[model samples]
Target: MNIKFKNFIWGVITLSVISSCDISDNKDVNPADSFLRIYDSHQFDHEIRPVDVTQTADNGYLFLGNYRRDDVDFLGTYISSVDEEGHFIRNTYLRDNNVHPVGKFLVLGGEHYFISMDAVSLQAYLNQVDDSARVVSTIGIGTTYPMYAENDGEDQFVLLSYSSVNRTTVLSLVNADGSITSQSAFGIGAGQEVEEPIIDHFTRTGRELPFFAGRSVDGTYYANGFYNYTLSLLFTDLSDNTPSGVIQGQLDQGGISSLLSLSGDNYAVARFNYGDQYANAIATLNTSGISSSTDIEGNPMLEWAYDEKVKMTTMTLGNADYIIIATTTKNQQIALHFYDNTGAYIAVDYLGFSSPYQLGAIQVTSDNGLAILGSTQVAGKFQRLCLFKKSESELNDLVQ
Candidate 1:
C-alpha cells in the first residue's frame, strides 16, 4: 500500500444499502452511533468509485474500488480503511501498470481476494488482501478476464471469468494461493453463449456486466450471465460445462441487476432492461431437470415496475435472518427494504435527500450495524465516494 495523499478529498456525506443483522443497542444511543462520510478527489481528473466493502475483525471497514484516471489508458485498484466511528484510517493506491481490477471481492477464511486482468497479456490475476487493506500477495490465475466471484459456501472461493479468445465463459474454483484447482468452460455447446458485453467492459466500451458463479443448496453449480447473447441464469454441471436448466431472456433485454440467495433454493433477483428495473422477490432454479423461466415471479416483494439502481444481501441476528434490499428510488433517495427470511416485507427506511446518490456497495458491520457505500455528484459533475453507518439498534428497528 503506497501512501498517496494526492488522490482524493475526504469529507462527510450520507448514504445507505440493502443489508442488515441483529443486536441489542436497539435502544437510545449518542449521535456518534450513526453518521455519514464522503470522500472525493481533486488530486486527479478521473473517476473514483467503490466496488466492495467488508467489516474487519477489529470493527473497522475496508473498501476496494476502481480508480480510473482520465489521462491513463487503464484502471487502477484502491484500498481504503476506516475506524469503527467512520473516521478515515488509510487510503492507498495499489498500482500495477496496465492491470485492471475486476468485479467484487471474494472473502474466504477471513481473507479478501479479488481478480484483476493484465490488459496486455489478457491474463487474470488474483490478489489476496488482508483486513487492514494491505495487498498480501498477487498471482496470475490465467489469461482470462474476470467478471464476478463468490465464496463456494465451504472454505474456498469460485470465480466467474470470460475468455474472449475462446469466446467462452470460464468457471474456476480458485484456491487461496491463486491456484486454479478445477476449471470449466461453457458457450461451446448448444444454446450456450457468453460473449461481448463482458469483453466490451474491459475494452472501455460497455457497462460492467454482472455474472454470478456458485453452487445451489444441492451442491449443483449455478451461474447467471450473458447466455446466448441474452442475460440469462443457468445451472451448469462443472464436470461437463453443460447447462441443465436456464431462464430465458430476450436478446439484450435484461437479467440480474441485484441478487441475494435466500433459504433453500430461492434467490432474490432484481432485474433491469435498458435502464428499467423489476423486482423479482424470490426465484428458484428452472426445475423439470432442464428448462427455463420467462420470469422469476413466485412471491413478489414489491410492485414490479421501472425503478432505480438495486442491490440486496442477507444479514443474521441471533437466530433470525433478515434480507435487506437497497434501491435508488425514483424519488431520488435510497430505499432500504427490510424483509424476513420468508420474503415478507418488514419495514422501509430512507437515506440521502439533499442531492442524488448512487449505491456503490453495502454490507452488515461486525456489530450488526449497516455500512452503505455510495457516490454523490459533487458540483454536479465530480463523482465522490460517500458512506453511511447505522447503529445496532437502528438496524434492529428496520427489521422489526
Candidate 2:
C-alpha cells in the first residue's frame, strides 16, 4: 500500500507478519446489500487506480490496478471480479496498447498474479489472470521492478526487483508457468558484491531500490527499499540466492510505504513521518530496532499538518488485530484508521467528498467486512474506481 501522487509531467508512478492467527467465525452474514461500491471510472475520462485486493477462487473479489485513457494515448492493466455485494462480475484489460503497468497484486495457489513493467522491453512482466480477468501468461524478467511477489511452494514463486545491472536488490525464482527458476543480486555494505564486489563510482550510482517483499519465520527472503533516501533492509538466502545481511538507517525518515511479517523477528512498518509535518506511522520492527510507534491521530492528522498522504494495511477481525490508516481528509475526505493489536484505538471512517481521495489497498471480506480499493473524485473532474465496504458491526461501531 504505497499510494502517493504528484508526478504527472506525464510519467513514473510506483505486508507482512503472522502467527497466533485464528480470527474467523463471524458467519453472521447479513450486511452487504451494497456497502458503498463505486467503480465509476467516471463515464469516459477513464483512470482506474486500485493496486490490490484479493479473495477469489469462488469467494469473488479480485481488483488489481493501473489504467489510462483520458480519450486516447491508452495504458493498461486491470482485473476486476466482484460479487459478495460489490457487484461487477468481470472486467478485463491485462495488456493493451502502450501497456505500462506494474502494481504487484498477488494470490498464489488459487491463481491470479501480477507484476508488469515493459513499455518496449524495459523488461519485467509476469502476468497471469483468469476466471475472467483474462491474460493467462506473460513472463519476461531480465530485471526492473517486478514490484513484489511471494509464494514458495505448490509450484514456486519469488520475484522482487531493482537491478539496473547489479546496482543490487534482485531476486527471481519464478515457475508455475513463468519460468526463471533462479537468479539473485543484492548489496548494501561489506565488499559491495553479490560475488563480484566493488563496482566503483559508488556501486554504479543507481540509487539502490526495492519496493517490498516478505517471508520470515525462519524461511528468510526479506527486502524493503531505499538507498539515496535511506531506509533499507535486505536478507536473502532461500537456500541459494545468497546475500545474508544489510539493514541500513532504520527509517531515518519516510520511505517505507509498507512491510509486514509480525510474529517472530516481528515486522510491520508503514512510513512517512517527516519529523514534524506530513505525519503517519505504525511501526513494530525487529532484528533489534523499533519496538512500537503509532501516530495517526484525528483532525485529519493534526489539522492538515502539511498536506498529508498515507496508506497502510493489516487485517483480522474476530479475535482482533488491525491497522488500516489511509489518511488525507479534512473536507477533501478519505480518512480511515482502525488500530487494534494492542495499540488500541479501534475506529474512524470518513470517505471522500469535495473531490480528492486516495486509498490503495485494504481487504478482508467474505463476510468479515472491510474492502476498500481506491481513487475517487467524480463528476467534478473524473478519476473513478472506488470500492468501500464496512461491516462487522459497522467496523465495531467505531469502538462503540
Candidate 3:
C-alpha cells in the first residue's frame, strides 16, 4: 500500500468530523485538511451520483450528476456550486425540473455549460449556465436526440446521434452557440448489422456505452463509434465521415474504452474486452488502414468488472507532462496511474475506504491538483454524491 493511501484511510476513520445537517452536510473528514465531502439528500427514495465536475473561472467548483427519485420515470440532473474551501453556494438552477444526465460539464471563455435532453420531445439541448449556477439559456440545435457530445479542445464540440431509420451514426461538429457547422453519418447496413445501441438507452430501450467524438491535437476529427459494425475509433473528415484511419476492435465485445490526446498522432488510450482492461502509453492513429486493438500492451492489465468505468486525462507541471488513467479496482477502490509524456509508466495511488466509492470523472484543477467526483452509499443502501481534492504538493510527489 502507498504511504499516502495508508495515511488517508486512517485519517478518514479517526480524524474527520461531520456537522450541521441541511440539504448537504459539508464535512472535513480529516484533520490534515484532506477529507471527503459527502453531499447527502435526506429525502427517501432519491439518489444522486456525480457524472462530471469542472473548475469555474472564479476558482469555485461546479459538479453535475444524475439525481433521481423513485417517482420519476427517468434520471434527472443536478449541479452544486461550492467555493474553494467546500462551502456551499446558493441552490443552483441546475437542479430544476428538466435536467439531463450523461453529458460532460465544460468551461469555455469563463462560462459553464453542458448538454441536456428534453424529456417531452426527446430533443437534445445545449445549456449555458451563469456564474451562480443558474441556467442562462437552453438552446436546442434543431436535433431530435443526442447520443453523445464532447468539446473538441477547440471552441467547437463534436456531437453523435443514432438513426434507426437510416441505420446510421450521425456526426455533427457544433459551435458554442448551439448551431451545427458540419454534419455526416456512418454505420453498417440495417439487416446485416448486430444490434442498435440498446435502442438508444434514454428511450428506455437498451444499454448505454462509453462514447467519445472530438479532435486530436493536430485538429483532425475522430470518434469512437460503429465503423462497419465494430466499435472502433474513426479518424474522419468531418464533412464526409470518411475514415482515413481506423483503430479496429472486436464486434461489440471489445474496443477502445477511453482516449486522451497527448500530442499530434499520439494518444493515451484504454482498451477492454469481456473481463480484462489494458492501456497503451502512446497510440499513433493518424495513418491509414485498420489497426487492431485486441492486445494493447502496457502496465496495469487490470481485471475489470462490468460496472467499472475507465477514463484518461492529461496535465503538465513545470516541463514534464503526465497522463493519468483512473478506474475502479477489483478490490473496490479508485486507482490513479501516472505516466510520463512519452507514455512511460510511473507510480500508482489509491483513494476511498470504509465504503465503495466509484470513480465518475477526474479533472486537473487550476492549481495543478486533482478534483475527483464519484458516488457512495450511506447505510449501505442509499446513493449520494462525494468529492475530494488532492493537493498540488501531493501530485508533485507522485511524479518524483
Can you give the lDDT of residue 212 in candidate 1?
A: 65
State the lDDT of candidate 3 residue by residue for 1-400, as single tens digits: 1122111111233321222113223353322223456655534356777778888777667877766544445567677776765455633424443555555775555577788777666667888876566778888875645666777655777887655556676778887888888887877444544545534445434445666777777877777777688777788777575677787778667888888876777788888776567788787654466787775565547544453677788888667888898887877678888888777788888877777878888988877778887777766786766777776667878789
Candidate 1 Cα misplacement greater than 4 A, ranges:
1-32, 42-44, 70-74, 153-155, 188-194, 287-293, 298-309, 317-320
Clashes of each: 5, 5, 2
- Give the poorly placed runs of model 3, Cα more than 4 Å off: 1-34, 69-73, 90-99, 191-196, 203-207
Q: Largest TM-score belongs to which candidate?
A: 3
Residue-level lDDT of model 2, residues 1-400, one tens digit each, is 1222211121222111111112123355443522555565312455777667776757667788767644333246677777765556667765443254545455667677777766554567777787666777877766764556766665666776666555656777777666777776654333334223111211222221225666666677776653322446656664554445545543334344455565665554544445333322334344433221233222224633232335566667666777776655545567777777655556687865545777766767766777777777555566656677776666766655
User: Which digits, one per residue and each the tens of the lDDT, describe model 1 over residues 74-126?
Assistant: 67777777777665677767656535675567777777777777756777888
- The TM-scores, one per candidate, come to 0.83, 0.31, 0.85
Q: Which candidate, 1 or 3, has the higher lDDT? A: 3
Give candidate 1's whole-model lDDT: 0.66
Measured over all alpha carbons after superposition, the RMSD of each candidate to the real structure, in angstroms, is 6.2, 20.0, 6.0
Best by lDDT: 3
Ranking by lDDT: 3, 1, 2
> What residue pairs are clashing in model 1?
9-40, 13-37, 13-38, 18-326, 26-393
Assess the local accuracy of residue 227 in candidate 1 as a C-alpha lDDT between 0 and 100. 59
